[model samples]
Target: MTATAPVTPDMLTIPRKDTGGGLPNLVGMTRDAMRDALIAAGTPEKQAKMRVGQIWQWIYHWGVRDFEQMTNLAKDYRAMLAETFVVAVPEVVTRQVSEDGTRKYLVRIAGGHEVEIVYIPETDRGTLCVSSQVGCTLTCSFCHTGTQKLVRNLTAAEIIGQVMVARDDLGEWPEPGTRTEADRTRLLSNIVLMGMGEPLYNFESVRDAMKIAMDPHGIQLSRRRITLSTSGVVPEIARTAEEIGCQLAISFHATTDEVRDKLVPINKRWPLADLLDALRSYPKVSNSERITFEYVMLDGVNDSDEDAHRLVKLIDGIPAKINLIPFNEWPGAPYKRSSNNRIRKFADIVHNAGYSSPVRRPRGEDIMAACGQLKSETERGRKSKAQIAAETGT
Candidate 1:
């Protein structure tokens, strides 16, 4: 799709890629899908379900990438699996470590299209920001990823494979048979779908991948530990809660529809009122399961005291936390980060309104891995200015 073409709301209505190519990579399939895959590969129907469990545990729980390492299966069966299927994730093209312990990976997938995955280490937990698409579909004015045109949505394998790739990097996997209940809280403890595309735009893949992420026999992350951030794709918001059941975060930068329309262009499709209405009835939102409102503090634009008060009033009844992100500026970004004092004032307004407002510290800025800075650094000149403007309307 060219950049300037107007995107239909349901344009990403097809499957991500040709999954039927070669041996299907078993990384992102649901248990039912995998069971069917095994049965189709000539496994006896009675043995398929049992075999699926075994292989699932091997790949996800133990991080085994090779069928040869699956010693429980017979040698013949192992050979069969190897010939008929491949366990694949995105390959890390380059890894950059920040001074503050964040690791950014440039991973190349099926078409040699690369996306960035970031792992940020904190005192209590380490969170990995995984991408859903090669480039974003939405043109959020302040985001660097919005500068690129949408290539294609990532397959389920490429989606969840991000976690596996990071696990490989952190050496977070356990010995095959030695995994325990405690392994769920490892260094790569939490996952945020805050990296690249509008995840809800690629709903099915994100849902299936997150289902695998929360599978007990695999990565085993708790539902609460996973947060899927969306750029306010209203219709899919409820579906996200039902299918994914992860924590929800909104890219809620501006308070009014007028400002939000310019900041997050998706707001034009699903305006702030509609987005807020969805949030108010979000399936599981509560005091504990509060939704996160990710507000990027752009200098002199959305950082005024009036904007802060308006934000609190806008999200009044929703059980929520305001994540005040100091805008992470890119080379051609139109906005600058708000002053520290302005950010503090904005935080104060929300905090006084009985919401938990935490100013998110800019992490991995040196590596361009901070919030809103995650576009594929690959494929720069491939997209012309007209194409980008067509896609993003910058």
Candidate 2:
């Protein structure tokens, strides 16, 4: 699609060059779909389910990418399966690690498009931030990724492949036929779909990929551990709860429609009223399972005391928490992060009003891997020698 054309997630064309040609990649298929694929590939119908289970464990549980590693299967059957299907994930093009131990991966996918995923290492839990699209459609003014035009929605394989790629980097997968309960709390503990795109816009693939994540036989993360952040895709809010059932986070940068229109442009499509209405009824939200309101602290913009109070009133009955993110600046960003005192005051207002308001300490700022700072290299325009000289003076 051209840069200016309106992006429809469902209709976007995916580059088939990475689909392993005629051989299907089984990385992102749901259990039932994988079973169906196995049967279609000439596995006896009666044995398809068992084969899927065995392969699922080998691929996900053990992180084995080779057919030769499937030692439990009959030799010829393993050969047949290998010839019929392949397992794959996004290819990591580059890895950047910040001083704070945050790793940013620039991964190349189909059509040579790239996206960034981040691993934030924390004392208690390591969170892997995953991307759902090649580039983002939502033009949230403060976001660097939003500065890039829409490319295409990631396929289910691309979505879950992100998780697999991170796991491979961390060496978190178990040996074959072995799993330990303690491995659940290993370095890559949580997943936040807050990396590079509006996840709700890519609903089906995101849902299916998350299913593979939460599957008992595979990566096996708890639904509570996976959080999907959206910039208010109202129609799919409830569907996210119904299908994926993970934690929900809203990219809510403003309390009023007037200001929000200039910040998160999607608010123009689904305004605060409609978005809040949907959040109030999100089937999975509860006291223990609070929805996160990701409010980026933009100085002199949406960080006023009144805005925080208004935010509290706006989310009145909903089980929610306010995540106060300091704006992670990028080149040509128009706004500044709110001052520490300003953020503290905002957090106080929300906390006094009975919601958890945590100021998120910005991570990976040195590598530009912090919140709202992820954008793939493919999004940049080519530079002429004059432009390069002007930029670098070399």
Candidate 3:
């Protein structure tokens, strides 16, 4: 279950990021973990629970990082917390705001490594695309992040910290004692794990971080509001429902195993048959809570009349929605996007069957914040277009 196991040579240079240089980080810990840390730090057993509640509200609900800002706690107790722990999130290195109101954040983590998180604003919801790893291992030929090699998995704190950072940028935190009700409208309403890395690859951190996100007194997002998109990690599918119970999305671009293996290389290991079987039995799938099949439209690649027909047939008996994403081009990317008419034709075919197939409008492309365009700022232009074409067979 260790992330380092599969990443042998890739993990040679990577060390587990320090937890605040040896002091425990309070940002990503579970409530029980925090309680244990508090008691270990000399808090009386009875007072530890109340102390954890106070610190949790200060750190999460109020967006306060400094222990001194937690005015409710005794000054001496605050001093003990300050000396024993640090509340930290990824540092924002550069932020880009798209013309369409999408914000892309390039944040610096420990070891000077970097990752990107995007906040996309929509009419009814604002979706933040969160990354799980520093780079990626899937190497999906159409994806920009896949071009870069994997670095390491992010810690639980770093995972949830992405949300905290976005909230800080959007000023979403309420004043102390203001409210904890779910009635108020939020600027960042929904979260999608469709950012830089395959979320299922770093399963435990993602689960723990999502648990923090859905906690009632803290960030307080509902289970239905958060969606975890994976590239069809079959074994972890059930755990996502039984444990986190958030929405599930699959990066299902192709209709056949041949096409899928070339585009999403991981499909070779767990092909469409196995992936579909897992989706059919997924505990979260129902009429109201359908699993999302994210299909990127690559011109003459995955977008065609036959592909659309086969796609609907493949997902029968499963409560599913198809998200037809236009291939978001990046520099040196080997594939071209499907034409609008072609994409719409494919959507029409799927919609004709019982499922909802909507062609996703390309967002934040001008700023390179669109889907499949998320690579670390440090890991760009290492390969020529011809080299990429050779690798992708374009």
Error of 1 at 154 (Å): 0.5
lDDT of 1 by residue, 1-394 (tens): 0111122211112223333357788988999999999999999999998999999999999999889999999999999998899888787777777766677888888877889999888767889999999888797889989877799999899999999989887887888777376634478889999989989989999999999999987888899999999989999999998988999999999999899999999989899899999999999999989999999999988999999899989998999999999999877678889999989988998899999999999988887889999888676657777876664446
**Model 1, which residues run further than 4 Å from truth?**
1-21, 179-185, 384-394
Candidate models: Cα lDDT each: 0.87, 0.86, 0.87
Q: What tens-digit string does per-residue lDDT give for candidate 3 at 1-394?
A: 1111121111112223334676789999999999999999999999989989989988888899889989999999989988999999888877777767777888878877889998887767788999999889999999989987898999999999999989987888888777556776688889999988889989999999999999888888999999999998899999999988999999999999999999999999999999999999998799999999999999988888999989988999999999999899887678899999999899899998978988898888877899999988665445577865664466
- TM-scores for all candidates: the values are 0.92, 0.91, 0.92
The stretch of ten residues in a row with the least summed lDDT in candidate 1 is: 1-10
Q: Output the worst ten-in-a-row residue range by lDDT, candidate 2.
A: 1-10
Q: Candidate 1, residue 118: CA error in Å?
A: 0.2
In candidate 2, position 232 carries an lDDT of 94
Residue 31's lDDT within candidate 3 is 91
